[model samples]
Target: MSKAKKSIEVEITEKKAGNGKTVSEVYIGKQFLGNVREDDNKFLMTTAKNESFKVNSFDEGIQELIKEFHLHH
Candidate 1:
């Protein structure tokens, strides 16, 4: 028997929303995953999977998202 492989390839793109606010959108292949944005100097992330989180630093926000999604370095 052979072991099946499980994998995901993510991509991020930075752009401006309708309000001209900066946002970084995350994608897995061609599927939209989530997004991160800055608010009041803090970083926030929202996902299409019903996950939302906020942090005081941009780096922390990104790290938390990686943790939440179980992504490996």
Candidate 2:
């Protein structure tokens, strides 16, 4: 069997939330994964699956997304 290649793309943009706060949007390919925002010097990741995670850094947020979506580098 052959292996399949996965492509995970992230678009970091300033998107205004309902509370008027800016958050970065994360996407896996063309699918909307979740949002990552900063709070108290920590990053908060909210996934599309309604899962939330408090990560230390922005990169960590991406890692969490990868794990959540079962994707790889």
Candidate 3:
């Protein structure tokens, strides 16, 4: 028998608010994942996951989610 591999699709969308600022929304399939807000070159990530941890960068967050997906598979 062989183990099955799990995969996840991350979709990111950027929108302009009434204040003329850009915000991003991230989605995993049909589920709402979270969003990221940036102000003056500062970035913040708000994700909805089973567990939470601090990641130094946005790429790290994506990597962590990939690892989590494989573990749950």
Give the winner by lDDT: 2
lDDT of 3 at 18: 77
TM-score of 2: 0.73
For model 3, what is the error of residue 63's alpha carbon versus the real structure, in angstroms, after optimal superposition? 5.3
Which residue pairs clash in candidate 1? none
Shift of residue 5 alpha carbon in model 1, Å = 14
Candidate 2 segments exceeding 4 Å error: 1-7, 71-73
TM-score of each: 0.64, 0.73, 0.58
Expressed as tens digits, the lDDT of each residue in 1-73 for candidate 1 is 9989987676888999898999988776776667889987888888667678887776666556656566633
lDDT of 2 by residue, 1-73 (tens): 9889866566655688788777888875677778888887889999987788899998898778768777533
Q: Is candidate 1 or candidate 3 better by lDDT?
A: 1
Q: Which stretches in model 1 have alpha-carbon errors above 4 Å?
A: 1-10, 28-31, 71-73
Cα lDDT for residue 67, candidate 1: 68
Off by over 4 Å in 3: 48-57, 60-73
Candidate 3 residue-wise lDDT, 13-56, digit = tens: 88887789776667778765655556565555565563455556
Q: Cα lDDT of model 3 overall?
A: 0.63
